[model samples]
Target: MGTTGVRTDRLGLLLAQFDQARETAQVRLTGLSDAEYLWEPVDGCWSIRPREEAVTPRAYGPGAWVIDKGAPEIPASEYAEVARQAAGGMSVAKIAEDWSVSVERVEEVLAHTGEPEPDVVPVTTIAWRLGHLHSGFAGQWEWSFGERRREPRLMVDFAPSADLALERFWAELDRWRESLGAVTEEQLDTVGFSQYPYGSDPDDPFISVLFGANLELIHHMAEIAVLRDLWRARFQLPAH
Candidate 1:
């Protein structure tokens, strides 16, 4: 079946619906507790449960702290380290490549670390946060296109508290939506978009990748929400 046969009007409407799902996904975890964050709906299954210590996507947002000894969460220092690297024109791709991380990974760090506070900051504090973001999205996007690749050998590993991960994920989607505002419809049909590493195909139109992204985005959002609900119930927390 020819892909171009899809109606543009329908596509827009579909995207809008996907947008709603995305919004709902983000809002689903507005109020949750630490215990609830770890609550599992079923036995032996893990949810995207956000923990204070849980690392979500490749990012570290506000309130992240690292003050332990033998420790990395030294915010001022890490900030300076990242800042110096950035000011020295350290691009995400370069960072990823240098650290044996994928380009998508670098992007995740940039998204989560947020300019490294313009100076050195704690390396340990947001380490998990940064790793999760990079790994999850990179893995997910790869899965979306059935073009999965070798795993990224990142510099660190971090998992967030389920709630925090959900929150950060929601925020990341918001970031995507904001960024999409700058994407043109013409661009949607344009060829060879590099934004999606494994998802975008050179032979396919932009709309095709857009369609795939639409589905992937909504699906992940729903998966996350369900994970939240399941986690809450595992702890006997009220779903309402």
Candidate 2:
């Protein structure tokens, strides 16, 4: 096969996978009620919440609702370990290895300077998972096809309800599909075809970015589906 044929095949496979995942997600989302969408089955599950109720250091959205996102503060006990490690002359790398965390995490802990770890993936609700998928698509679309100037957090408005969120989510999915549809054979092979700032999109071939995006959709949608199942079974009697 020629180069053009290979590109067409690759792009075709990506679009097909995306479409399938979208369809599956839509099916899972059918008749999703606001209660189910916002249900927090476990303690500290991240989900859409009123702006005033948001616990994250930074929440995304301009509306009454916001997504619980952003780096969580380290706990006081965890920070005490950092202090202990530091006083013991442990290198940042050694501390990170001992904690099974990244060196950057160790640095952040050290730089935190004894601040208490704030009470904080937190099993996310359907709403939070959907918001994440929406952000991924919308962010990629904005950077790759739109003005390419604004960050996605600034570009998206968090939906306040299940219906509205689904509406906006579908719209972003369409935009993403349209953008992918326009990629040329040469563009797929070109590095930095997608200038999305959040990930390594700008450093990799467009095809690699496409595959990653598809993977995100597939996995997140499956999670949403499983959440829906758990929600439905929450009130059911267990089998003996």
Candidate 3:
């Protein structure tokens, strides 16, 4: 295949993944109510709140941003214990028993089959996640293709409420998506196509940048879907 043909094929595959990611995010957001979109199941979970009500004393870096309540970093000892068990060829059930977690939980982490049961863990709300998706698209597009400027759509600006957040998300995402069509094969092959300073743009090829963008979509969609599941379960909604 010629250079253009190869780049087009590569970009086509990434775009397919991008579409699937967006669909999965949309499905997760469907029927998400305003209350649940802003609900914080754990104290200090990063979520969208009113400008005045978004106070978080425990916040680090950006306050009340997309930071979610997270599992405490697992101890090195625990990681070593898992490694030890695996080296011993212990059964998953045995590993679970030794590690003080459910067999299902162990399997979930090992096989990556399911979301962990959301405990009183810190987590971002649907509104916050949606705002993040929009911001990512806008930020990437601006730096990579459009004029690189200091313009940034902050979470608080667009994510005051669930409805408005969703509206902005679609608008920004559509604009970002449409802009991809203008990227030529030569541009895709060129290194430093994006001068976005926050990431690998300084050294990596444009194709790597595209791959990184796809990774953002896939992982964030999965995370949002898990958060949606947790939100539904928090209210004891029937898992339809």
Candidate 4:
């Protein structure tokens, strides 16, 4: 086949894969309720909360977003270990004073001290996942292809509700698709065509960047799907 024909075929194949991933992501996000979108089945589950209520443990860490609440003085993960060390000897007042939480909450924590620590991968709300995808596409497009301007975006800018989030997500996908379609054979084959500074793109070919973006979208979409399933089944699990 001719060079033009090969380029067309390659781009076509990539586009098809991208569209399939996009459709799967859309399907995963369909019909989510607000509560479900923000569900936190376990403490420290990263979900969209009001600025005042944002409780993700990493929020307080260095490089956390300005809007994200700082981590509690005593992280939720450490609570179990701390309680175990106390071994039913630590008073609620002492625990609360040390952790900087309400005494009532401390008592509750003490009661559940014997339970295993939550093994979560920093659960994020559906809204957060959707917003993250949208921003990721937008940022990569802007940094790698469009104008090369590093404009920062916040998750809240995507959408406040599931319906709006889906709408915005598809719109960003469409923009990404357009950018993908515009890549010529020369651009794709050229090393360092994508200069996305935050990633390895500066040292990679445009095609590699495209493939990486697909993997990211697909993996994150699957993660969101799993989170939704867990959210739906949150009430069905028997207490340990």
Each model's lDDT comes to: 0.46, 0.81, 0.63, 0.67
For candidate 2, the TM-score is 0.77
Query: Which pairs of residues collide in candidate 4?
Result: 46-123, 60-71
Which one is best on lDDT?
2
Model 4 / residue 21 / CA error / Å: 1.1
lDDT of 2 by residue, 111-191 (tens): 775456455437888989889888888888887778888778766677657999899899889888987888988999998
lDDT of 1: 0.46
What's model 3's TM-score? Answer: 0.64
Tens-digit lDDT track of model 4 for 70-90: 345445576665575357465
lDDT of candidate 3 at residue 151, scale 0 to 100: 52
- Evaluated at residue 134, the lDDT of candidate 2 is 86
Q: Model 2 off-target regions past 4 Å? A: 1-8, 72-120
Superposed model 3: Cα runs more than 4 Å off: 1-8, 54-122, 153-156, 235-240
Using TM-score as the measure, the top candidate is 2
By the TM-score metric, which is better: model 1 or model 3? 3
Error of 3 at 54 (Å): 4.3
**Shift of residue 63 alpha carbon in model 4, Å:** 17
Ten residues in sequence with the least summed lDDT for candidate 4:
60-69
